[model samples]
Target: MVISMAAASAPTTEYVNMYTLNLFSLAGGTTTSSTANRMVIEFGRGNGVVLNGSFTYGADGALSGGTLTGFEEYYAGVKGFDVLGASVPVLDFANLINANDFEGVLNAIFGGIDSISGSPMSDYLNGMAGPDTLSGLDGDDYLDGSAGDDVILGGNGADSVRGLEDNDTIEGGAGDDDVNGNMGIDLVHGGAGNDTVRGGQGNDVIYGDAGDDGHVNGNLGDDQVFGGVGADTLYGGQGADVLRGDEDNDWLSGDLGNDVLYGGAGADRFLFRAGSGVDVVGDFNYAAGDRVQLAPGTAYSLTTVGADAVINLGVGDQIILTGTGAAGAEWVVFA
Candidate 1:
């Protein structure tokens, strides 16, 4: 049962309802008193929900009511059954709406601008429409920010995080993760793992931070990608971009832009293809297996312009390898 409740405006009077619900009666039980095995609150607001809060039951399965206090205390007032003729504002139960009954996966579906965290088990956390925050505490989780500009954290697992529409900030905390910035200009950081980060369709900023053999791709727009540590692979997909492979033996590909590629400290390979616009390889070390790979059947001519070697691909696209001059031809491969 998906129960969606929209928050109404504050009441004229200041009466917060600290009411206790009869779980047995609500579930249509035969006995006078019983307990609800689990309560699934759907489309709920997450204004002031803490990470590990819980509800308790008596030994006889009766509701041992707990204190539920939050932002809804001021906004979500319910009318009709009032005590002392004053309207009662519903207690903001942890603004988390559970989508499933399974023990393994905790699906938190938040409606309003809220913040929520997952359990130690694997979870599927979704920030449905608000500018919210979702944190996957510890498991191989899946997190999606469906519409609003959200903040998502893959806390300590090999997770998959997606910012579906608006400008979001995503961090893959500990394990190897796959992070995707789907639509708007986002900021993504793959932290402490050999992760794959993609800037999909916008002028995004992505970082493959502290990982070995990580992959960072700027799929479209004028994006910026940084490969923080280890042997990483970076790609500048379409618009004019900047790709930096900070350390180790990395591969940098400026696929179709008038791009700037900086092979920071490693023996890096700069890849070029047909329609790859005029690009610049900031530090191409020809002696350290740092070469340029071109697409097959690409008509190209090499020329020396002072200290740089320019591979002009006949159709107005060229790659300028800095400092190598004619010697760069030995490091250029057609494959």
Candidate 2:
């Protein structure tokens, strides 16, 4: 049975009500009266009601007196009454709850409630207003942020979380989880295990922590990414992964392994390690000031149409030809 109550009192009055509440077997035996087995009371306003008596239970799985586990004390200046013993307060009353009241209830219950404790197949659902925090304690839970700039914590067991349409922070606590930043500038962290993260459509920051992490793209503006402590794959979709520069000069670095680098437009530069290769194909154009550096054990060939020099090298044979004249300066080496 669900019981809901509301109090109407003057600025300086104390109101109390009691009912013969049934203590069901699901709520545990009334003999387990210690604080560990007691019902948890959460108050909406700072100046609300208090639970004044203890609960009594009968042998037929029925309750004699209602359970009076705890009391909620609201600050004297606050305008609302304290909700007595309801697990979830119904603040849907008009003018009783504003944006601040909704937010205060969430902040008061951040780590205070345990949705699931001992079951592996259990799930908990919570709803809150803007700038709220939602934590999925255990059992592969799923969390959804309806609205506002919210924070979500996926505790354990390979959870899946999504931010609906606002700027949100989603964290994969400790499992092989999939996190997606649906919209807005979101921050997502794949806490541990091989996690897949996607930054939907804003300049978002994504971190792949410990395992092979893959990134989709940074759609607009400059996006920053790091594949932390693992073989990470980063893709700077549209905007340049600008390390340092001005006027659309973005930088991308493929650290460790054979990483492919591309310079799309503008005066972009490619930085490679000692054992890297840079390949150019198809009508490649070079200005007078452009330079190319070949690493050790690396080879480069160029074919020109007019007043240019071309070199072709073969096994055990060499050639050094140089001239601007039409005679075609040539040198040949024998096997």
Candidate 3:
């Protein structure tokens, strides 16, 4: 025997000998033992249940031995399930069950949950269990790739992003920005404006799209930097700045002005036209074996050196000459 109690208004009785009974469209009501021999009670919309006696299921497949009271006045829709004698509604177990089942009945009750249309202003933050795709529909927003190889975008505004703990890809769009890949191998791009980027703890790739940009302390790992257009500063903080005197190299200029350059490691080349007062300074170990190729009719002087082949140039002078004998080579004025 199976019995279910539901809240309904008025005491109504129906007799059925079957083990299973499906009750529908009930208000709030109570059932006495004499009311039925076996029972199945189903709570309809806006229904509540209050059981007064111990319930037992009979071998004949009927719900038996329970008294249900306080059918109508005890249950209310907006207030949830009210207590048997209290006017104020308290936290009820009924609401928990209803809320838990709300998701299961969503398709039948209201067709289906609809997608949000028009502009979206919220940023999506996703967790490790997701191989997730998030869109920053149309706002200055922030998206996080918490874990799992993720992709993030700064839709607009000067946005910032940190790839917390995975190999992630991030793009900053249409604004001055900062991007950091906190762990794992990552790829980052500064979409526009003066942007600052760092590959926190991995062999990372960063690009400065436009405007003056700065890179600091991007440790270990072979990294690549391109200062795209405008006067940009590139610091191969611990590695080499692959100096290609292309259209984007800010240090490769040919006008007569005091300039400073450091080739921290590896062979750093300084290419200049005549009249560019380029100064190269560093310890003998870092300055040695680096070449400064000079153009015709350029005036330069190598004023100080820690060793015979090591030299530092004072302000308003240039280092000229390249080849095997170039280091510690004396500067001569060409008329």
Q: How many backbone overlaps does candidate 3 show?
A: 14
Candidate 1 lDDT over 96-127, as tens digits, reads 21222221111222345656565455666666
**Model 3 lDDT tens row, 1-335:** 11112221122222111111111222223333322322223354433333332345567744434433222222223221111211111123223233654322222211211111112232322322233333333444455555556566665656666677778777766667676766777777666777776666666666666665654224434454455554454543333323221133343322233333433334334444444454333321224333455556554455433333323343434553322233544332122
* Cα RMSD, each candidate: 12.0, 16.8, 19.0
The residue-level lDDT of candidate 1 at 13 comes to 31
Cα lDDT tens digits, model 2, 1-335, are 11112222223343211111111111222222223223333333333333333544466633344433333333343322233323323222111223334344433332132221211332333333345465655556566654667677777767777766678888877787777767788887777766766656676776666665544334443455545544444444444332211122223332222223332333333232332222221111132111222234534344443543333333321111123212121211111
Q: Judged by lDDT against the true structure, how good is candidate 2?
A: 0.41
Model 2, residue 290: what's the lDDT?
A: 15
Q: Would you estimate the TM-scores of all the predictions?
A: 0.70, 0.41, 0.41
Lowest-scoring 10 consecutive residues by lDDT in candidate 1? Answer: 80-89
True-structure Cα RMSD, model 1? 12.0
